[model samples]
Target: MAAVVHRLAGPALLAHRDGIRAVYAAAFAEPPWHAEPAEADGYLTRLAGDVQRPGFAGAVALDGERVLGFATAWTSSTPLPGTRSYPRVTAALGAERAAAWLCGGTEVDELAVSPAAHGRGLGRTLLEAVTRDAPDARCWLLTSVRADATVRFYERLGWRQVTHPAPDGYGTAVFLGPGHPARAAAVLPSL
Candidate 1:
């Protein structure tokens, strides 16, 4: 069956909470993520709080009540954040570019598609559903360079890599959405 993608407001994601957790547990259990089961628990906790953040928005793909994928995003702020991968992202882009290009833009925090749904384009559909309302198409996301296929997937979707992923391919790469104002200038793939 074809899946339907829905743009959800904050807190509303909780309606599909269990389904979301199931997809997260399955999608991120391999490759660079290798998320521990406990991480899924932590994600649930974080989602509860994330729903309250300003400009918070999300999307969920349902194949008849079963969540096939999901995406979450919210507006970023100046000075950057000190949590999770934000510091590394900020350093890679530098303070000037970070604030000008990313701050106030939609920051995609999470996007997951179940392995079972991999070839059906649900990933791209979920991403666009979540980012469609980004102010000026100024949306961005970061993923580990270790996830080579992931990097390529975003590139194929017209996202531009803004920061060099790293020499050993160990660092995260920040990507500017296709319509971002600064997309043209971020052409170089080297640091």
Candidate 2:
């Protein structure tokens, strides 16, 4: 059965928070992220503010009433906002490339597929839906280098891993979307 991808924002997202949380918990509870239920609950509180940010957008993949996966993004500009590894990303990519390739571009803050939904294309669909209208299609995201399958999933979708060393304490690998200026000279190493 095909999962229906719905583009949601603002109030609609808030209303679906519980469904989103369920999917988030299921998706991140496995290897790599291993996020706890409490962490997933914390995300709901954060989501309240995230949806209010400039250009906030999200997509949820659903099979009937069950959430299969989701992706969220928002526009980020200079200074990169001081939250949740943004500073690490700026440090990893250098202030110059961060401002050039990421600042003012769509930042894919979260992309997760329930373990059962893996390989069903829901992750890719949600990612594309959330960033579909980004200016110049400039989109970027971060994932754990240890999550080999997740890294390959994004790479397979044409997201290029930026060559900069993963910043300490971040444990993340940054990726640049196709056509991103910074991607021109970056090496695509398998994580």
Candidate 3:
């Protein structure tokens, strides 16, 4: 069955928390994420609160009633809360650039596709559906460098890697969305 991507927000997204958790568990259990079921449960608990944030949005790729994949995003602000990576991203991009580029911009918090859904273009469809109407079309996301396929996937979709100051923990790699103002400035000058 061909999967169809649907944009979701507000109560609609909250209503699919179970489906989202199911997809996340199946997707992240693979090599890169290795997330436990408890972790998915914890994420759903956090997502319950995240939906209340301003500009929260999500997209799901569904084959009929079954979720094939999903993506979620929200607007970011200075001193981004809840994760050490935010500080590292700020430090890497600097206060001025980070503010100009990321603050108030959309941040892709999660994008996951079930292993069974791989190579079906559902990931790309969900990604575009979730961020298509982002503020100023600016969006960003972080992923582990170890996830070569994941990194390549984003890069293939025109995302630019920010190559300055290395992230401190977990080898996180940050990417600027296509057409972002900071993308051109964030590239390290060749020696």
Q: Identify the leading candidate in terms of lDDT.
A: 1
Tens-digit per-residue lDDT, 28-68, candidate 3: 88777788988889888888887787888888888988888
Off by over 4 Å in 2: 187-191
- Give the candidates in order of TM-score, highest first: 1, 2, 3
**lDDT agreement of model 1 with the native:** 0.87
Error of 1 at 166 (Å): 3.5
Which candidate model has the greater lDDT, 1 or 2? 1
Where does model 3 exceed 4 Å of error? 188-191
Residue 114, candidate 2: alpha-carbon lDDT: 80
Per-residue lDDT value at 123 in model 1: 85
Error of 2 at 21 (Å): 1.0
Q: What's the residue-level lDDT of 176 in candidate 1?
A: 92
The C-alpha RMSD of each candidate to the native structure, in angstroms, is 1.9, 1.9, 1.8
**lDDT tens digits, residue span 1-191, model 1:** 78999999876788999999999999889988999888888898999999898888999999999999999999897767888777777777777888999999999999999898888888898899888889999999988777888888998999988776542355777889989999877758543
How well is each residue in 115-186 modelled by candidate 2, as lDDT tens digits? 877888888889888888888888888889889888888888889988445777566878988766667767
